[model samples]
Target chain A: MLNRPATDTQVTHLQRLWLYVLCGLVIFFLIVPTLLVIPMSFSDSRYLDFPPESWSLRWYRAYFNSPEWLQATAVSFQVAFLTMLLATATGTLAAYGLHATRARSSRYMTVLLTLPMIIPVILLAVGIFLTFAPVGLNSTIGGLMLAHTILAIPLVMITVTAGMQNFDINQEMVARSMGASRPWAFLTVTLPQIRNSVMSGALLAFIISLDEVVIALLIAGGDKATLTRRMFLALRDEIDPTIAAISTLLIAFSVLMLTLSQILQSRK
Target chain B: MTAADHQPDAPMNERALDRQARAEQRNLMALSLPAFILVGSLVLLPMGWLFWMSIYGADGFTAENYTRLLHPSYKKTLITTFELAFLVTGLCILLGYPLAYLASQLKPRMASLVLLCVLFPFWTSLLVRTYAWLVLLQRRGLINNWLMEWGLIDTPLKLVHNFTGTTIGMVHIMLPFFVLPLYASMKTVDYDLMKAASNLGASPVRAFWQIYVPLTLSGLGAGVILVFVLSLGFYVTPALLGGGRVMMWAMQIERSMAVYADWGAASALGVVLLVMTLGILWAFARLTGAIGATEGK
Candidate 1:
């Protein structure tokens, strides 16, 4: 019923071509940088150069052998994992509570939750810097996770609440009446339905925590430096193909996670 | 008879049980307490600190910070930021709407694929994406290299480190943001209405302009506001692409705070940006409400 042509076939063809071109442009730009990084990573020269005369795994080996890169990446992963856990737990509970409430109150709470996303990270970093300095959170893992969690929580809340909106609350009630406790009902009846949303939210939270730099720079200082912070420092001091190698790895990791999420989303 | 029959003891027991249930509900709602505590401690508290810092001075509370930002150059920087945000938002809408429309017209599987493509770039690092743009748009980078090879020009074009390069990179980052929301809103539009309009002897364009555009305006507005606000706060893209050529307010704030260690001026700049964002958001909410009312009618 929906696919029937409502207009001239010629126009639709033109539209399709135009759409393809636009989408092609997007795809081209999206992948070009990533592809470019491949050649730069293999560059025979010491600097980041395109269309290298010779290709080798020098930079890749360099990255793998360097303890600094390895340690920074591990730190990034640890921070991201902890931030994801904190964000998911807080966000899922908050979303469920807010979603079950009346519309007006929920709307107000939603805006409040979005503040972390809407406010500038620099402003956030400065405030956290001041607040954490007094409490000795500066240059500590706890401080980094705390800052990252604040930003990540809103993302989880938004995604989970979106999933909850379309849910049948009566089913939850039915489960409750069947002698299932509230927590048990939620686990059996609600969690599975919104599992995809939760996973996506968690993925988003992890990515944000991993990619974040400004807060890490401000609070983590030098000791708790993240991979991004390390890269930022590298860029400040020099331009090298090692960054290209790291970028390639990051892109690959993101793609793998995204593919997994896609598989999960499709199951829904 | 009704008052007496409503037996005092029975009603009292019900009231006590009700109070207990209410207490349980309060506990359940307390699930939100952690979020509240976290946000208050990390977010709201920090913002309060920022506000205090903005007003504080070497001596005490003073107008010096705000007044310092009142300089002509600072004013220019603020205006440039607003202007850049406005332009990027506009460009995103212009380009994003058609793609969203076409995407909505696709089969579900294909639509999902298209959406994946849209989101793929978004998942990539912004730092890397900006750097990629630098390669493609650089003087002797890919674009100009190809152009020169094909005899389009003898000399390489000035592409990177300017307004043109900045716009290109900013728009690339922002397109998906605009597209996703617009696509979400467009999915909710009634295809039957458009078909009915066309079936009633209205041309496709006429029906689209008359009905489709109006219905989708809320989505467009939402997307525009999202992009604009995001662009205002953008740091990496402008920093990389502008290459010290274009100076926006965020860059100025960074310089003041990081380079000069001038917290007062930086905080003042931040407050101004915050207030402007809040004001625009208020306006957007009002517009959405107005549109909602019209839609209800």
Candidate 2:
């Protein structure tokens, strides 16, 4: 509208046809595979072939009924929760550090923090396994949390940093001028401003930890198996429809997260 | 120094604030140390150790590990990894660029919805999405079932347990990475620029390639590097979809650890990968900086 052409404003028929075809292709790519999972999950037969002989909820039932699967799911949730808490707190503090100091060290600190994300996860997994070897930290939930925390910290850092760009430095200055301690000035004046960023980063970290399998698989053993690890093992050992069922559930959960994130971002 | 110019009460308060600010800085650093140490110990130290082991040999320091990696068999593996990463990144760009462009063209409400569709799978496990591909590409899988029904083929095509399946799965998993950054960058593109180009007698295609493409280079650079880096590390997708036949470097490292119990070889492989990643990051940074300097000038 700001810079329109001299030509007449009319919809060309060929352009409209092309537009429809493009939109159709986009919709097809996005929707079809997601929809395909539904019937695949319900296949009455043992194999994963489509055009099911009949549809049933047996796989869904199996997913819920299996103790191993349920336990893994519970573990995943717990790990994700802890990861969010740890990553959000540390990440926000680090972001604040960068904001407050404007220190050259903060740049170095950010690299240190985000190194986990930049490195290959498998390599990170191997590193963690070796690092934990001397201390015998293998296969423990605590060790798994630590590994996930490293990976998750970068996410929190990025999100919180983005959020902190809107920080009102003047507010802190004002508080300081009133003889408030810097910590008090920040806690009372600054933390509240970036709360949404903190929350969103926490949520993202949680989802990342929950959905992570490679690290969880490398570090978490036996009783510490995450839902993803369970799914991987299930897929490798058996062609159960239960995996499809679980995948459907996970996809729904992801969609829910995506919606929530959008709603939150829009509100901002 | 500013306190010297302050009023009586102002000087006292300013002094206190200065002390407090210093304390806050100190405290922040103190709090950050634990995170730094934790990551450094776990990631940094082990990475150093991987490099150290890579150079160490039976007779002391030797490049035998690298020499071993140069074997024809391993060369094939390396080529396949690059090929897979290259193809997957290309496909992601192909599939992602238009959707990003289209999304950019949409109303805010519709754009958000389409963006949501793209990001939906991101929250799910990469393993789950790869597993979905397994079901979709297996010999007796959904696609094969549909094709046989349509008489498109009398026999199921060898889709899964091969390169095609691996590429499809990797691209699906990586598409979001390509789209999100491109979309974000494209959204920031000045719409008026495109319109101005068209109004100045340029065709729409010319406007897009000339204005939009060059402007979007940073995001494209980022998106491609991200997709390539991620694809390099991809394990579950190739393993699950490629069915043991697709021996990726990640699988090689896993075998070196689990089956062979050869820490030296595994760490050496890990070192090679780490170096490759760092090299990519360095190159990306240099390229971006040059672009930035050029843009600034």
TM-score of each prediction: 0.92, 0.92
Clashing residue pairs in candidate 1 (N, C-alpha, C atoms within 3 angstroms): none
**Runs off by more than 4 Å, candidate 1:** A1-10, A46-51, A102-104, A236-238, B1-14
lDDT string, candidate 1, A1-268, tens digits: 3344434321455445656687667666546655687677777777455687788888899999999889888889999999999999898988888877543555666778779888877777777887898899988888888889999989999889888877887798899998998889889999989988898889988999998877886677665788888886675444556888888888888888889778876766
Report iRMS (Å) of candidate 2.
Answer: 2.6
Error of 1 at A112 (Å): 1.3
Question: What is the C-alpha lDDT profile of model 2 across B248-292, one tens digit per residue?
Answer: 888888779878988888988888888888899999999899989
- For residues A175-255, what per-residue lDDT tens digits would candidate 2 score against the true structure? 989999878987899888887888888889988998888887777888888888878877777677788898888878877
Which stretches in model 2 have alpha-carbon errors above 4 Å? A1-13, A16-20, A48-51, B1-24, B57-59
lDDT of 1 by residue, B35-153 (tens): 77788898888787788888987898899889888799998888878888988888887778877887887889898888987888778877667766776787767788889989999
Per-candidate interface DockQ score: 0.48, 0.48
